[model samples]
Target: AQSVTQLDSQVPVFEEAPVELRCNYSSSVSVYLFWYVQYPNQGLQLLLKYLSGSTLVESINGFEAEFNKSQTSFHLRKPSVHISDTAEYFCAVTSKTSYDTVIFGPGTSLSVIP
Candidate 1:
């Protein structure tokens, strides 16, 4: 079984400040990790993913995440945050054998302050 967890449930950052949203996963079997963003009153959108190849993956919106196998973590980071970046972030994990079944973390709400 695979499970995901986010360290902070809420993150508040000043505009143009760097921020990081931590995500950790625990699974006996190999799995894939993904980060999704949900804007207010909107559907969740894929931010980034870590399936194979490089340990790091990035979203087009200036967000990046590194999959650390040793740490069992896939933390998302952004150098500078914009007000438009505020949203709910989810950490999802799925086993390679059971890709259809995805487990999501509690979620982290990011608030960008001006």
Candidate 2:
């Protein structure tokens, strides 16, 4: 069975500050990595993903993460965040195909303070 683990349950930061939300996973077969964000009362939106080739992946919204196979980790990082960035972020993984459904970790809530 595959599993994803997110180290922090919550992260609180001021606007324009840097932040990192840790993630680690274990799977017997090849998998795709993804990070999704959910705002209040909304569904999850794809943030970034690592399928193959480059170990690093980025979101259009200034967030990035690297897939580290050896360590079984894919940690999300943002150099600076806006108050609008406050949301619940989920780290997920799926077996190699789009048809393969993702399994999510307990989400990490990011609160951006003024």
Candidate 1 clash pair list? none
Give the per-residue lDDT of model 1 (tens digit) for 5-113: 8989999999999999999999998888999999999999899999999998989989999999999999999999999999999999998884369999999999999
lDDT of each: 0.94, 0.94
Q: In angstroms, give how far residue 65 of model 1 lies from its true place.
A: 0.2
For model 1, what is the error of residue 52's alpha carbon versus the real structure, in angstroms, after optimal superposition? 0.3
| Candidate 1 accuracy as lDDT | 0.94
Q: What is the TM-score of each candidate against the true structure?
A: 0.96, 0.95
The residue ranges of model 1 lying beyond 4 angstroms of the native Cα positions read none
> RMSD of each candidate?
0.9, 1.2
The true-structure Cα RMSD of candidate 1 reads: 0.9
